[model samples]
Target: MTTTARRGRPRGEGTDARILEAAHELLLERGYDGYSIDEVAQRAGVAKTTLYRRWPTKDHLIVAVVAKIQDDVPVTDTGNIRHDLVTYLEAIVAGLDRMRRVGRGREPGDRSAGLVAEIVAAAARHPDVGQAVRAVFARRNALPLALLESARARGDLNPDARPDVIFDELAGAVYYRLLITGEPFGGDYASRLVDQVLAGARTPSPRAERS
Candidate 1:
């Protein structure tokens, strides 16, 4: 059988996959500002109408790609909040490490960072992207929340401690170090964050400290 004839059996399946793949690659390459639907269609080797039939708009297509790449944060009941938090943060740091690899060798102020920032900004304006991003964070936090709750129940966390605020602080530190400060993301940094949070959560009473 000919190549076209053999593969033609799937009909629109191949075209749809191509469109999605093309959109993903172009979005990462050109970002929101530089990407266009027509360009995507051309890259995918499909008609403009075919691309539109699958995704009405570029925003919709980007959202779909983001959803497809969204990953579940792993949860582990390691019996120690510090260990669990460290593990969770390490997973996040690993993701950033991957991004750094992807962004390497690119020009200064290039599309890699610009693309991520644009997508985040766009998510603020687009309800579909916002919802999808929200869902991703929600799922990501499940394990951390469980670890926090377990710590509180075990009297490890401060009685007035707020897990949401704590998690945000921890994440903020890591993000600042990785994205802003250009500091290395490593096990030591993760361990330090866990220690910092734990120190803050320690009971302030001298007696509690002695115990």
Candidate 2:
């Protein structure tokens, strides 16, 4: 069927898909701070009431857009703990690469950094925005959880250490470097981080001690 005909088919799967597509595009284009329900409705060619019926607030719409892009990071069983850790950190680096591209055309660190700052500011003002940000963080932590579990199973983690603690120790360092220090987070950084985490997590082998 023609695209116009399909969009005109009334309330169904296609309409919902179109609305979500519009929201996604707008979110990326304008960021959370500048997005508007009326613009989204116009872009989707749907009524403002329809958009409101689905998402009561901009926070809800932002969360829904994030949900659509959510993907599970694959946990690899590479036998070598260092390798698995590098792989996990590299996945995050890859995501940042895409975000960088999306934030292009603006001044240095203007697009992505500005958008993140705006989201944080919005969260401070709106409880619902804060909740949505928390939800996004929780959803994004799934992959890190898998990596931690795998390390624990392999006896690479200290017996007394909690998974959340380990995750914070590792992932939090990368985040601090990325968001705060604005350092280069390439493959070399990933390797170094893996080495650091492994040093802290792995028990020294008796053979290595003897050597």
Candidate 3:
């Protein structure tokens, strides 16, 4: 049996954008604990009911903010697989580092993950939040995966190379450092990671070697 679809008024893009922007700003300022739905409504100039209609909980709003942050990261494919991967990985590293600093007054060498840890914990505690978080990562990571596949198709990478495996190695290392090891990852580290991944997965072409 099929159920009838219920239709309602379409939400305005402008309102959604404003709410997300307010939420993101507040998340960076107060982190997950201090982030208040009332404050977000006030900042966005939206009604509490209206905000709730869009995001039923603060966790949902925060996850949406994370999704927006991931969307803001650009994935470039300039035909140079190594350079492109390195650029994209560096961007991810920069974004993670920024997230690690949210709501914290720590120094440059701070190992604490800050708001990132909060996001991870929230996602872990709630299945819906966890699913949303995974969806955002999958959506964002598809770009790089496609890039790797394209490189493989163009003979730049080894025939036996798996894009998923390579990406896990690259991205996983950064996340592991952020979530588990509490180590800092920078652009230089991203560059080296890309080099290592490509060196193993890429073909023995002079062009690949040059990268």
Candidate 4:
């Protein structure tokens, strides 16, 4: 008698989610330094081969966990570009804050980048991880980029306003503060950031206005 072996990922199983959930918990508990891929598989109740088949490496698993968390943040295009972008960015800031605090114990006035920095360093250290990181960001960034395009199409933004550039500027500001300046993303930062970027993006040139 001949029997066929099981196929890819099994049928209708929540294995992916289970692994990601376990990874997320372990990452928060141990951070990058202490995080163990083997332990994640055990906690996820999945065979080591199953987890390895999906993520292959710790960096890949970590990136997948980050990507999964990112999907929870919604991007709503309410037609008001300023308000929409502000709201979207504020959600992003909240996500970043959670990542920034991951694995770091409570301390008075803590400002370190924590897990955020670890992910970055991991990407830099491994070429495959770097590629995965870029791919995740590229896929995840499309919604906001599309939102900017819609704004431009609706004349809510200057025709010269480049969505990619605008997005980079907006993203860069917060990242720079977090990674370089150690500035807080609290208070009116999200609103202020939106207003500042929109100041340049919203107004068309005099010639454009006349036309």
Candidate 5:
């Protein structure tokens, strides 16, 4: 299907950008429950019918905003896997921190990070949302996965190392620390995370040392 057919806007047009920007700003200010789609349309200076024609629902708009946020982070192969991964993690952490400062309306302390936590819950509850979430991640994850694979091929990582597992570990650690443990990541967190993941598994096996 064509891009226009799917979303009612040509992929490069600025209407989508304006809508997302408005939605993101409002979300940070008022959180998930505080704003409505009509407010977003009004803020963007677009008609409500036009916005609905594209997003169809508020949840879809949320996904689009998140997608834009993820898409803004640049991914380049600088040949230094550690540096690249650290840069990416740092950006992700900074972005998430911005989103997490305000919780949902009722719970001031909600660790779910507002929009992200909402989408995660929505994805779990509704299969369609889950599909959309999967699509978003799949697009976002491709680059990092490729970076890991390149590092492995270049001998920067173990020959036996699985990029997917390592990717999960790195991302999982960050999310777990933020959402589950509520621990704050310091300025050096990205460097520390990269060093630990790379150094711990690049060569030695603890079992081998013991045996």
Candidate 6:
């Protein structure tokens, strides 16, 4: 007689969404340290085991929330690198600004990184969390990277324009302001950033072109 292979029970529909929604709300209401997996389970109306089965650790769950935020932004290619880059960067700025407000009671124009700072610190403190955070960024950046590649191929960007370097310039400025200088990532900054980056990366006119 042959034994039948055992199969795990399927997850209940909407359980993950409920958990994520609860976690996101709690994260915004309370800072990262103030929230707990048990609180998430209680708010989500799901068992702690259910939450763990999906997210092995609290850091893992937090990374998942951050990933969701990243996934919500759209990256488009309209055959115009400047417009596309500006639009994409503006979306990223919006996400960062939103995350910056989470669990903070600062006045308007505050430049605090808030939960984003906690995320970075968590990643640094835990190797697995660092890998998870890096993976999230790597996956999220693929679209913008592809958009740059398309622009380069279409002659819209300079032949020497490196997408990774260009991305570093664009994203680094935002993070620098958020995490270091505490400068306001105000409106129009995205436009200015795109203009500067594209100006350096655009093909020069024949009159100004060097051999």
Q: Taking the tens digit of each residue's C-alpha lDDT, what string does model 3 give over 27-113? A: 667766676899999999988878887798997897888888788778989999989998898888998888777553667777877
Model 1 C-alpha lDDT per residue in residues 1-211, reported as the tens digit of each score: 2344535354466776788778866766766657799999898887776667667888778776655544534668888888888888887777665554453266543323333455676688778777876776677677688789888888888877888888888888876765566666656888898898788877563455574
Model 1 alpha-carbon miss at residue 198, Å: 1.5
- N/CA/C clash count, model 2: 0
Clashing pairs in 6: none
TM-score of each model, in listed order: 0.69, 0.70, 0.78, 0.80, 0.79, 0.81
Angstrom error at residue 155, model 2: 1.6
* Residue 191 shift from truth in candidate 5, angstroms: 0.6
Q: Residue pairs in steric clash, candidate 4?
A: none
Worst 10 residues of 5 by lDDT: 1-10
**Candidate 2 residue spans exceeding 4 A from truth:** 1-31, 44-50, 75-80, 107-114, 204-211
Better of 2 and 6 by TM-score: 6
The weakest ten consecutive residues by lDDT in model 2 span: 109-118
Cα deviation of 134, candidate 4, in Å: 0.7
Rank order (by lDDT, best first)? 3, 6, 4, 5, 1, 2
The per-prediction tally of clashing pairs is 0, 0, 0, 0, 0, 0
lDDT of candidate 4 over 181-203, digit per residue (tens): 87887778989989999899987
- Between prediction 3 and prediction 5, the one with superior TM-score is 5
Candidate 6 C-alpha lDDT tens digits along 1-211: 0112212656655777798778877766675667789999999997787788778778889888779878888888888778888888898888888877755476777777877787787788778888998999999888888988998898888888889998999989988988899887768999999888888889553555566
What lDDT tens digits, residue by residue, belong to model 2 across residues 70-145?
4534557666667877877777666554554454355654424333444556677789888887788787777667
Instruction: Looking at model 4, report the run of 10 residues with the lowest lDDT sum.
Output: 1-10
TM-score of 1: 0.69
Better of 3 and 4 by lDDT: 3
Residue 85, candidate 5: alpha-carbon lDDT: 96
- Residue-wise C-alpha lDDT for candidate 5, range 1-211, written one tens digit per residue: 3334547445446778898878877776676567899999999987776788789877798788768778877788999999899999998888777677643353655565555665576678767767887899899999999999999898888887788988888888888877678787899998898898988658754566674
Whole-model alpha-carbon lDDT for candidate 6: 0.81
- Residue 157 alpha-carbon offset, candidate 1, angstroms: 1.5
Q: Give the number of the best model, judged by TM-score.
A: 6
Give the lDDT of residue 70 in candidate 2: 48
> CA shift at 36, candidate 3, in angstroms?
4.9
